[model samples]
Target: EKVQLLIARKIELFWTRNFSEAIPYNNLVIGVPKEVWRNEKRIALTPSIAANLVKKGFRVRIERNAGLNAMFSNEEFEKEGATICNKSECFQSDIILKVRQPLISEVDEFNEEATIISFLYPAQNQQLINKLSV
Candidate 1:
């Protein structure tokens, strides 16, 4: 029991702790898009994480040039089995991973059931939240 507790605590430390319904990795496609917010130049996923997810049977799609700001090349992601695609294609994935709140136009292009993980500051982004809630 102590060992189990220790391992669980380690997982918790590295986990996002969404505590929501879990989705099978194989059934989901994770996408990493370029941060378009002015002066905010961070990509959501690293090549290592993409490789790990791919190994776990998840499809990872990264937008072309998405990680340029972070110094991650497409070849790196490709080596990890992630598909380099257009921004629109990336946005259509089952899960969109990003660092900034998406613009309204970008949100409109998201897949109907796509799960987006980002820094969504709801209080400051009421309009974005309203649009997303729709």
Candidate 2:
């Protein structure tokens, strides 16, 4: 079973490298930062979800108090193996998840080539798209 899993992983790696520009889940550092958009009180991830990702070997980092608005405590996330980090540290992650588009200042904090998963309407978010496109 272990050998099969290894072979499958190898196949997945090869497929990603040759076909898609996708990163392996286990190799990703996923960050959940606090929603800073006006009147936004949502978070991208919850403690239970983060815990599942951790179990799958993904590194999860959540900004301190990111879940406060969602009613999910930092302690809950910590107990589930997610690191409670500051804003800068969270934004530095390889994968940043957010409830809405980030502010300009927040965009500057992302490491080069970082991937952000968030809601975006290109027509209304041209500036953000242009910035990220480069």
Candidate 3:
């Protein structure tokens, strides 16, 4: 019981120390795009995670139906302060998060200054790397 109490206290302290104050808004935006890779069903960010980011003063934009495959509804994300937008609008964000590598053609939709985070198999898809590097 005592050990459990100590662990709980530590967890509480961690949350308080990290999330007690909202970070000043610096115009940082994170976009979540739907997985286009075949058989990929997971989404990069969940509604809860988006909510946390919003509380920290970050803007989150999710492409329409991005989380549908993961059993998360668009309304769920919107309730957490995320904006649901079309794929093109979501791709315009400063940072893009995806569960799988985007299609080669979709790479051209990304903003030149945007950063992409996803499970990429660069070794197997040299063409994708070349396109993304351009």
Candidate 4:
């Protein structure tokens, strides 16, 4: 819990200190996966969050139909200045925020050097740790 809080605080601080530069000036790209697994309906980053990031000058790209199951549409995200992209292009982003770890099938979509962050179910996902080690 302490670690989580500290990480959260660090994220908040990062946004506070660097959001202005990170978004507009640096051409930061963020990727979000379309939910594929069962019972994963929640989107880790919503259009509202995308809007905030854009307001700070960041460019966000999301996988096609990623938010459809969540009742979010491509038009809504586009309205917030986020670009809709194929899974491959989404993985080319500088950073990725995913609700779940990359599945074996989607592993190829990730760029070799991009930073991908996601939640892993350790008990059932030892393979994810190994895959991400790449």
Candidate 5:
């Protein structure tokens, strides 16, 4: 039985390694940031995305208090198997999907190597882009 258990563990590791290799490194960690617009009740990605990410074997981390404005609670996100983290940690994810342009503080909160995905209204807020570029 001990030998069987060892074999099973090896098989699991082998499969996991293969699966991870098949998926691109960029696709591994996904981040979802909440829009900071005043009275903005819309959320870019909902719990549905979290569920989908879980099914795809990807890790999701959302900014704390981000979904509350949209009426989605932290519990809902957790129930969908998404990891709830602070703004700083969430910005460290490989990909960040956002509904609005990132705040200056939020941009500074990002991990230098992380990829940020958002609808940046550069035309409306050129100063923000300039600030971020610096």
Candidate 6:
């Protein structure tokens, strides 16, 4: 009976750990900053998408004026459960999503474990790549 109880406990532990890791989503904060590049007017993560993420337990933060170019107002995002914050606040998230590659100077604003998602041309921007690597 002792051996059977030990085996059952071990199986439960194993399944708990494995299944916990298998869950696809978490309550990670996702940040969306405005496009700062000249003539760049694109914005990532529309209000509808942000709302869907919120419904899925993710927190979405958008920088002020982030969606103006895309004709998306801050009120629209707020209505969809997003928080509109300053540029720096947007950088302090678990994930940062931008429409274009961020400037080298902007790389320092990222959180140590933050993941940046954008359209980067590393070949054309070695300096930016090096800054990001640091």
lDDT of each: 0.92, 0.89, 0.91, 0.81, 0.80, 0.90
Identify the leading candidate in terms of TM-score: 1
Displacement of residue 129 (Cα, Å) in model 4 is 0.8
In angstroms, how far off is 79's CA in candidate 5?
1.2
User: Quick one: how many clashes does candidate 5 have?
Assistant: 0
The TM-score values for the models, in the order shown, are: 0.82, 0.81, 0.79, 0.75, 0.71, 0.80
RMSD of each: 8.5, 8.2, 9.9, 9.8, 11.3, 5.1
Give residue 62's lDDT in candidate 6 (0 to 100): 99
RMSD of 4: 9.8
Pick by lDDT: which candidate is best?
Answer: 1
Across 8-121, the per-residue lDDT of candidate 5 in tens digits comes to 999999877744345564368888876787888777779988898788788888877789888999889999988888777778887788888788777777777676677788
lDDT of 3 by residue, 8-109 (tens): 999999877755564355588899988887888899999999999999888999999999999999999999999999999999998999878889999999
- Local distance difference test, candidate 2: 0.89
Q: Model 3 segments beyond 4 Å from truth?
A: 1-25
The digit string of per-residue lDDT tens for model 4 on 6-76 reads: 99999888878743333453477888878778888877679999999888777799888889888899888
Task: State the displacement of the C-alpha of residue 5, model 6, in Å, after optimal TM-score superposition.
Answer: 26
Error of 4 at 116 (Å): 1.5
User: What is candidate 6's CA lDDT for residue 14?
Assistant: 87
Residue-by-residue lDDT tens digits, candidate 6, 3-82 = 99999999999877744343344658899999998998889889999999999988899999899999999999999999
Of the pair 2 and 5, which is ahead by lDDT?
A: 2
TM-score winner between 2 and 3, please give it.
Answer: 2
- CA deviation > 4 Å runs, candidate 4: 1-25
| True lDDT of residue 20, candidate 5 | 32
What TM-score does model 6 achieve against the real structure?
A: 0.80
Which residue pairs come into collision in candidate 4? 23-57, 23-58, 24-57
Please rank every candidate by TM-score, starting with the best.
Answer: 1, 2, 6, 3, 4, 5
Clashing pairs in 5: none
